[model samples]
Target chain A: MSAATTMVGRSIRLSRRNLDTAIMAVVLPVLMMALFVYVFGGAISSVQSYVDYVVPGIVVLCTGYGATSTAMPVADDMKKGVVDRFRSMPISGFSVLTGHVVASVARNALATFAVVLVALLMGFRPTASVGAWALAMGLLLVYVLALSWLAAGFGVIARSVESASLLGFFMLFLPYLSSAFVPVATMPPWLRAVSEHQPITPVIETVRALLTDQPVTSGRPALAWSGGLLVVAFTWATWLFRRISSR
Target chain B: MIVETEGLTKRYGTRTVLNGLDLEVAEGSVLALLGPNGAGKTTTIRVLSTLTRPDGGSARVCGFDVVRQAADVRGVISLTGQYAAVDEEQTGRENLVMIARLHRRTRPAARARASELLERFGLVDAADRRVRTYSGGMRRRLDLAMSLVARPRLLFLDEPTTGLDPVSRTTTWDAIGDLVRDGVTIFLTTQYLEEADRLADRIVVLHNGGVVADGTADALKNSVGGTRLDLTFASREEALRARSAVGGLADGPTLGLPSDGSAAHLHRVLDDLLAARIHVLRVATHRPTLDDVFTTLTAVAA
Candidate 1:
């Protein structure tokens, strides 16, 4: 009944009503995983178990793609003038952005689960106990939340819907550039250094270690990065949202 | 006054959109802010609706200061923008229900209100269909319905029927009429002269960031000019000849002369044309329309 809850519910309902968006959000990541694991898996040589190395990468990649879904609804709402409508109403100023971020994070969680399920069906063998799996999922969710907010910031800044939708494509490149399918060392030194420093690499590395029962301490950088990214993106998105709504 | 402003100013970058402007609208009445594009009609609505703050002056809605008490102002007013601000992906019913819920209606109440609005707007059959499937008129009606969920005392409509067909525009007008009868105050902006003429009790003509004319529609129309007899001829030379003989302004093949709207005035014009042997293709008396008022006022301001 509150403004925040109402906005979130409205966003979720809107997402549900758009059948194509739902399909694309859940299917695109799975399709990408299948293509890479089957078609490109044989060609990729750095990983001893390509499925093991690539599945975590795909999960993170899918989360990144989920950011596109987040960006689009924000852009669509802004373009349609619905943002102005919300501003004119006697509701919490932050409700609209809160709704979008919440809804996108929920949708991304489902998509991530679907990707993991497909990975399991593709013979991904995980030796981690339930606690480690929980931690991995938590870390993935924090990353998703952070990226979704970043996408939202981009969406608000974007002048057009095309620009907003395309902004998330930069996230998709993380998988290829990072040690998702291959070790960063195999890549050229410059690319390897760039890949090692980006946020996705550490998260993927952490998730991979968690799934394979490796020492989880290596993943600490992933948590720290995700937390920092969430803070920066959340702040930026809040400021952008206020600017857009007030304007 | 349901809405009041004084010395209100707004600027985007170096260009001033709304110069120091003053406005007042009484409760339970319709006030139309009429202007051409970029005349700051929308900017005024934005300020009054609490969507945008003014650069320099103060505005109040329902007695609440727009800046200091914006939340209170928002609680008393609603705005339907130039575009139908509905979610295309959501069905009409869903859109209405969502807004009702946001207004703090209970779940059942929200559903009931949504159904009521759908029926009222004649959108019942298409209520469950996505808004993208609805026609422009339907979407606009739904947009209006969404704004009405809270039953605010004052409603702001910005170019409410800019892109609608004649029939759709008529329907929208009738809907606005219903709101007026319900004792709800309406502040609407439009570029269409006839829309302001037919709907607004008081019309404010905005030009170059200020009110150029403010009065009843009839008063504004009458202030521009009086009745004139437009005589169309076969050629510009004949029109010029007629202009000299009849003593009026000439434009191409037509000579526009002021008329007293009396039988003798018509008779003398006919007699003069007959004696001059100047062929008159058409002769019609033109009453002052809001279009004339708008053109004259804006021309003077320019």
Candidate 2:
């Protein structure tokens, strides 16, 4: 087996051993989607049925939650000397971080699917065709890639796992500040402007339009943001990995 | 030489950790880099292992320049840092297998290698237990075992037995000895004098970011001081009497006198004690320890 495959397998096994991570990645996102659609669904004014309106947002939210999942394990590995051990070995340098990223993407993708299942059970349905579904999935994956590598960067610089987790907490609330729960137009002008420009807004808006078969003026900007974020975060993460590992 | 460093220097900001250091290690021999804390033992190891970059000078391991040919250097050497560096969440068997697989071994080959290492390190019984449950010694053994997965020609061990118990230290020593017997060149660092004395074919004393002394353990010890015999008496007065009669240094119930550490010297010392009618409780010959050499050399450098 190749170094990347071996490291990914090892990372997955290591991350699976943490019960808190399992709850955070899989259970908490599904629960949040259910609560939002059931308890808070009727209060929203702009959307006719909040279940259909909020499922895409929840999918984006759960996928973003993978930031913490990626960060915590990487930080733990750093503290535990496993990263140092990997550095001294005669293997591909990218394998260690790549392993954590691939595992995080796999795990968050599963959680995103679970949220979709729960949303479907709550009377939410997508009007888009199979190709649109595939595109939506691709967009969610791009978000995962951007966030996971960014979180891995945070983990690399963090002195402890708690610090890395704290660094990732802002990503969870990003969807809240944007169009995840309520329409940006419903907010005041300033808040709406801020919400529309944020990364999550473009992503949620694009995914929402695709699933609902609505016109997507935001798709180009969303693709640009995701692609750009992936590049910047991947470079930042690789730079940090190189600097620290060489020490 | 399997490893050589020429004026190898590393600095952390304004502080110099390794300053114009030079070292050489022959193949298939155990070379111990002996030093106290903050003496740059670990920095030297890191440079040689390609884990850290040198600010100045150059290092080569297994004939590959550590900076320009790092991948080649890494391909031929394995380093076990001061910490065990094993994954605590994984079982010993799993850790070994993970490393073996990373080294590009086949699945079955990795498994076979892991089992062999587990048995050789006497970790077979605890192979399935998570490393978190293993004792420090067990974790260290597993760490050493993991480093040997690819059977690199040279091994770098930084303070391998720093926190182990006596029995565990001995076991680790035996394990290292076994590796050397198999013709693996070992470069280990330690603050323990006895560790260097017992395992090192040649000891390099690193002090103040430079090599203060380097030679065989016996040569370093002899360079510090000669042998001396300590005669213990039943009473202080008797020891003093024997000291004056034998022309030796006296302190309470013990008299210390220089000797060649030969049987004849011992017999003559006993003969002097008998002539003086001093009752000797015990007699011990003291050869200068690595501690003595280290302290003296570092003191002189200071």
Q: What is the DockQ of each candidate?
A: 0.73, 0.57
Candidate 2, TM-score vs. the true structure? Answer: 0.89
Candidate 2 C-alpha lDDT tens digits along B107-220: 999999999999999999999999989998999999999899999899999999999999999999999999999999999999999999999999999987899999999898
> What TM-score would chain B of candidate 1 score versus the native chain B?
0.87
TM of each candidate vs. truth: 0.92, 0.89
lDDT of each: 0.87, 0.88
Candidate whose TM-score is highest: 1
Off by over 4 Å in 1: A45-48, B233-280
- CAPRI grade, predicted model 2: medium
lDDT value, residue B53 of candidate 2:
94
After superposition on all CA atoms, what RMSD does each candidate show versus the true structure? 3.5, 5.6
In the range A77-124, model 1's lDDT, one tens digit per residue, is 888889889889888766887888889888888888898899889988
Candidate 1, pairs of clashing residues:
none
- Give the CA lDDT, 0 to 100, for residue A165 in model 1: 80
**Candidate 1 versus the native: TM-score?**
0.92
